[model samples]
Target: MTGTPRPRTVLLTGASGVVGRSILREPTALRLLAATHSAPAPEADGRRIRCDLTADRLGLEKEEYTALAGEVDAVIHSAGLTEWGLPAERYRPINIEGTRRVIEFARHAGATVHFMSTAFVAALAETAPVALSEGNMCRNYISSKWEAERLLRDSGIPHTVFRPTNLVGDSATGWTSKGQIVQLMSDWICRGRAPFLPAHAGIRMDFVPQDLLSKAVLRAIEQDVSEGEFWVTYGAEAMDMDASLRVLAKHAAYLGRDLTIPPVVDPDTLTAEQLAGLRPMVRNYVAVLRDVSEVTRCSGGVLPSSMPELRTRFGVPLVDDATAYLRSLEYASAHLS
Candidate 1:
């Protein structure tokens, strides 16, 4: 038999993250050089390269860089620190400096680059309604991403940047994961996390499933969109947790299960004292559930002027919000204890 075609090589930084892992499932004719600070448990494909991006030298010597440079066709910079506890200085070294290094390597290696940025970089005035477009000025995470995007655009390399909203989906089964609001509500119902539901249950939230995100990443590469940021997310009407939870409770009630689903108040209406009295855990819970945005022309929302308009866009074909809620419920029921 003839030899298998030489796989196009992709160097991905965060290969083990929820979205990064989904990307591995796609059948691409590429050999992936997976990089991480530490070793993850065994996965099906790719050669693992252990290099702490934060190290003084990035753990990559000249010879190693040259060897891999010859093999890689593209770089997908997925590794990043997502939690907010870290100091800004700590973020720059990895999120910014490490990115600089990867772009440098790509320049030498003759490979296109794909960078994973988040939607929060579009931090609008807390007082301003969420004005999320690729070019909207970001004060926090957005600053780092925007800085990196500037460097990439000037680097003269073919690149694609994706700023996705909150990601959903089971990391294991390509289904929904329990960390989502719907699952959180299901748990609050089933596990009795609270005697009452959140006050902001009616607020709209935007999310992108990991499977859809994976497809978008591959699509971006195949279509070779001009170098700029694109928002990869669903355009479905944002689901209010309070309303969706009622739907879930009804589904359970129809199944002959006994449960108490309380009426949830919209967070926008809560007084400061009411919010302050919430348990610390409950406060943390609200932070993740409360913020949401619709980031596409598909949603009839305005795209940012600075962000390059994507000629190739993948429309999300999810079921209605109710069905999406229920599918999320089924996901919650399966994974949550």
Candidate 2:
């Protein structure tokens, strides 16, 4: 990795985010500038800069913006609103417009960008088994990212786009800066709170360990990958619904608790009476789970993957998927709960 010429100083936007923290933890020799909103980042001791994505020049003074532009030749564009279920308008100012600002800054800095996009964008595909409505939980968020990717593509800037599925934890130690949606949803299921698994048939549950994603990005940076699109997902190698439930059962045994694996229910089959029978909160949770399952099922029954490319091109280790997930669950049980 050291033999290749890489960027001297790299600007890391969203330095306080989960992916950003994982990147900070990864071994790297490049000097990194942590561009954050307001929260102090790991690099806050020296290279952290506060910025507003909605503001021009990231809300930095003219001199500071110029100084930053001069210092970096590469950017890890990881910043954006990732929360699901928000209105379309809520995502515009941050995810879409903020990316536009980042593109402007990159243009000024003459820096190549490595963007972090979500695999959930597949949900909006015309080939999806289930059609997604405007009110679908993450439709707007996914669309926003898709638009941002389009912006970078049209800008004629040298950039790489990585569409990662839901991230879990480190492959070895299962460490995460915070619990991601994968962990939270797994917890809810394993704790026997999920009345039934609301998912599409044959849809694989794809969740990649965060560190692998971090390694992929850093290696792409180190190798000076000029232009490419990669899906950092497990695809067919990912666990199926039955396998996922078995992992939960294993996790329960590890915790000295017995768990009943919930029956899988296709949301489309549920009648109004059955839907009304669920408590309001459970109904909402089920709806979210169902929508997420549909999202996972978008590109046919399985999501598209770039795992083989990641390993061959970037030297990412192919750790067992279920093992990584169990380690994550164990870590959350011990540390993050």
CA lDDT scores, all candidates in order? 0.60, 0.88
Name the best candidate (by lDDT).
Answer: 2
Q: Write the per-residue lDDT of candidate 2 for residues 1-337, one digit (tens) a residue.
A: 3687654888888999999888888888777888888676763444688888999998999999999999888989999999999989999999989999999999999999999998887777666766676667989899999999999999999999999999999999999989988888888877888888888888898889999999999999888897999999999999998888888999989988789888998877988888789999788778888878878766676888999999999999989999999999999999998
Task: For model 1, state the Cα shift of residue 13 in Å.
Answer: 1.3
Winning model by TM-score: 2
Q: Which stretches of candidate 1 lie over 4 Å from their true place?
A: 1-5, 39-41, 124-139, 170-186, 189-203, 223-228, 236-243, 250-269, 291-325
Give the TM-scores of the predictions, in the order they appear: 0.75, 0.95
Clashing residue pairs for model 1: 14-79, 121-142, 170-175, 199-265, 200-267, 201-242
Q: In model 2, which range of ten residues has the least summed lDDT? A: 38-47
Candidate 2: deviation at residue 7, Å? Answer: 6.0
Question: Candidate 2 has what TM-score?
Answer: 0.95
Looking at candidate 2, what is the lDDT of residue 248?
A: 91
Structure candidate 2, residue pairs in collision: none
lDDT of 1 at 150: 72
